[model samples]
Target: MQNAKPLPSYLVHRYHGWKATTWTENRAWYRRLADEGQRPRAMVISCCDSRVHVTSIFGADQGEFFIHRNIANLVPPYNPDGEYHGTSAAVEYAVTTLKVAHVIIVGHSLCGGVKGCHDMCTGHAPALEEKSSFVGRWMDILRPGYERVKDLPETERLRALEKEAVLVSLENLMTFPFVRSAVEGGEMTLHGLWNDIGEGGLEQYDPTTHKFVPI
Candidate 1:
């Protein structure tokens, strides 16, 4: 901590802003949420992109959604190997402990992590391909999704893989026994979403239509 810098001035200003307006307006709701504990109705798994604000995008109040973020927003297939799994642990807690009724995997355009994975796989970024690359290994979860969209034009592959990341995560979510049980028992629902950051548009995956439709 000796070498660590103080909090950014901009963040300090933003916190003051939130405390003044957003927090003040929802003071009672915030207090109630604190006293009663969080009972979020939904769990959202999304990318760790700075531009993606899950709560703001959904217009959710404090403690309304349990969110888990990771590179490319990809969820690895359920693996109980007695190893550290942050995202899976969050999902477990959300489903089994929090009893969330819905699970949403939100993917977005121009995701750096997804782009890195694409570059790594296509030999565009050799550093990420190295075995020692932590990000490279984590992004490997999206490899299957990339394979599904590999044939698209160079310009379009990235966008296709972005959606594929959501699809893969949705499929991976079912691999969790508790998640599958809840979903099958009609206690929980799963959703996939893709957002176009530049366009400010959202698309939801429609299983019946097997497509991502504008919502």
Candidate 2:
């Protein structure tokens, strides 16, 4: 038998076929969107992990949220001198330009990046002192996680650290002037979330509760 190529139906998205019907369903809404412009309601900052997909979890439509993904979902402290600042740039645009009402930092359990940080902390692996490792440097933002959860056992400790990293990123998001101003002005709210892809449960942070509860 000849080696057959994948079907066009498999390669081509079904959404492309639904264009006419989709537009018809929301014709008036789309007309207003064209006239006004896209104004997304929320902005999501999530990890670049292939296992954790933000769009599917949020059940978001295309124009509902602006998304930014980086290693471990870290939001670094704002600095003009830093050579790489793509994440910060995205946050600024979402908050200042798009004027999103919510900024969500979603982390996940069993993250490879977080596990790498855990390994470095336990001295199980050699310290990545060299600048040559791009991913190692990116994982640096979650370094503090190991120390903070060092007292607990490996399993529980790592889970706590993973959640802690989300909180840390939420704090880092506030360091940006645009984020801070929007938050202070009641224009935006910061949310820290953890998704357990392995188990299929969502936990959202609650300020008053000071803990994550199933949502």
Candidate 3:
């Protein structure tokens, strides 16, 4: 507790500004949302990258989206070993409780996590190869994705691996029984998206064509 501290001065100032403007203007809506709880239509699984603003990209208001951000925007294969599974828990809650109609996995260009996986798989990042590195272990979820794109030209491999992360997550998500049931029952849909941050371009995976087309 001794190390705990109040919000930083800059963040505090920003919060005050937002509270005076946005919060005050939407007080009634905020109150109603607090009273009724959230009923977001979609669950967005995206990377923890600070630049990837999911809500801003979609023009979503508060309570309109259930977003879960993690390294490389990954979803591991379902394993109920009584361990802590933040992403999986979020998925279960959104699917079973919130009953979101769609689950969207968003991957992005220049993802550090994806790069780490690439480096680790290629034996370029020795520190990440250590057993004690949390990020290294986490990025292991995308190892298979790296393998799929490792042979491509160095220039195109990163982008390809980035998209592959989305595909891997989409595939891993279906390994969950509840997700599979929901999709099979026509109660839910799954989507994979890749964002080109610099170009402000978005591409969506097309299952039929087996490609990502710009959107």
Candidate 4:
């Protein structure tokens, strides 16, 4: 707590503005949500990128989606070794506790985390290759994905790797026993999505064709 700092002036101003406007206008809705608790129908796993706004993209309300954001939006394979697994814990709660009907993995174009993974895989990012780098260890989950698209041209490789992040997460999600059971029992469904930040384009993975199509 000694290292904690007060909110910046800009953020303080913005908070007051939002509280006076948005919160004031939705006081009843906010109170209802606080009393009833959240029962979001979907869980959205997205990147820690500032550009990727999950709620805004879906025009969702505050309690509509149970969202978890992490580097590269990657989900590691099920490893219940009693260690701290933030993403896994979020997924577990969403599926088992919240009983969300759908789980969505969203990747985005020009993702820094995905690019870091690509660079590390290609030996271009020595810093990320270090054993002490938490990011490097986390990104190891996407190594298989990088291998799949390493042969492509430079222009396409990054984009492909970005989409691969979503694919890899989706595949890893199934590794969780509860997720597999829920999906197989038709209690839940999984989805993969990619967003083009500059172009404002969104694409959904088509399992039937193994390709991404504009949605």
Candidate 5:
């Protein structure tokens, strides 16, 4: 079992085709960017789910997005303690050091993290207190959003709450001095996106319309 037989037929075929030609030839560019400090133009907060690779979903090339993903793509209000704060630190660095032009908070359909938050608010979530898991801690950021939208229907409400969570993170983005300063100076913009995974469609939040507009 240790000695694998042969490459899978699909991968073997792909290796002789697009994957081989494109990514293989482009490896040098990626290496060069890494060798130099990457100055990405955008910062994306996305889901930690394996299925939602932000770069792949956005069709972004290497070094294009300074991306951070937590459960449900949450961004806690700026809090700088001595302990590990991976997501918040990434945001601070991106907005301050990297000076990204835009920050996008991305949410998606049928997100497990969103479901977890919903369940937690309704007292139906798994007994998570016993374990010190990142998911448990990270989902806390969506608590306010869940509570605010709890009166809506289950299927529709969860989805709405998920979008509300993205907006909440966008609000959190403003809590950072660097981000707020940049936006006030008209140097940066914040956006919230909701992706319908079932239909492979995207909607951008419009504050004026108070709705998600297909994009």
Candidate 6:
């Protein structure tokens, strides 16, 4: 096996800076979290985008949110196959064990994952169709979302499908028995969010309006 590499000089400097500031400032709270274990009240499923800061966006403190970031922030339909299901496992742990009161699917504008799905489905990215593309396979979850927006103007479909990613995830979350039970029994709630990367605007999905409204 290869040995782990050392941190880059710039990252090491940043780490030291944080350790002297934010970390030292919250040393006790951090220790308390480690001692008592995390009890986050919400679980956030978001994209793996560098600009999407889940915690900073909510002004949340440590242990405030249990976040799971994936490509396009999707949740697959419930499957009980004894295979590696990273997203599903996180959801199970968050809902059943953590007993989080809320599960939020947060999508964002100009998501490369969403773009990849768009390119892949539209015959633009042939490499994604191969069995070897992890991203392509993972993005397959958004295929249905892509279909829903296919009829729209090609120019407008990507943005529409980005929101659809959040909607699709909300629907898939219900496929899990525990999630469905908790949501239906009023013990837990589900939410969908779409964030504008450049504008910094946040929108919450409104089932009644069937649209994303400004938050």
TM-score of 2: 0.83
> Would you list the clashing residue pairs of candidate 6?
none
Quality of model 1 by C-alpha lDDT:
0.93
Considering summed lDDT, which 10 consecutive residues are worst modelled in model 2?
Answer: 121-130
- The Cα error of candidate 6 at residue 109, in Å, is 0.4
Give the TM-scores of the predictions, in the order they appear. 0.95, 0.83, 0.98, 0.98, 0.85, 0.98
Give the poorly placed runs of model 3, Cα more than 4 Å off.
none
lDDT of 3: 0.96
Q: Over all chains combined, what TM-score does candidate 1 have?
A: 0.95
On the 0 to 100 scale, the lDDT of residue 211 in model 3 is 93
The TM-score obtained by model 4 is 0.98
Task: Kindly give the number of clashing pairs for every candidate.
Answer: 0, 0, 0, 0, 0, 0
Candidate 6 lands at a TM-score of 0.98
- Report the CA-based lDDT of candidate 2 relative to the real structure: 0.84
Which regions in candidate 2 have their CA more than 4 angstroms from the true location?
A: 1-36
> Which lDDT tens digits does candidate 3 get at residues 70-112?
9999999999999999999999999999999999999999999
lDDT of 5 at 84: 85
Tell me the tens digit of each residue's lDDT in model 1 across 1-215. Answer: 69999899999999999999989998999899889999999999999999999888879877989999888898999999999999999999999999999999999999999999999888999999889999999999999999999999988899999999999999999999999999999999999999999898999999998899999
| C-alpha RMSD values across all candidates | 1.4, 4.5, 0.7, 0.8, 3.8, 0.9
Poorest 10 consecutive residues by lDDT, candidate 1? 54-63
Instruction: Report the lDDT tens digits of candidate 4 across residue range 81-101.
Output: 999999999999999999999
Runs in model 5 deviating more than 4 A are 1-20, 129-133
The lDDT for every candidate, in the order shown, is 0.93, 0.84, 0.96, 0.96, 0.86, 0.96
Instruction: Compose the digit string of candidate 6's lDDT tens values, residues 8-111.
Output: 99999999999999999999999999999999999999999999998989999999999999999999999999999999999999999999999999999999
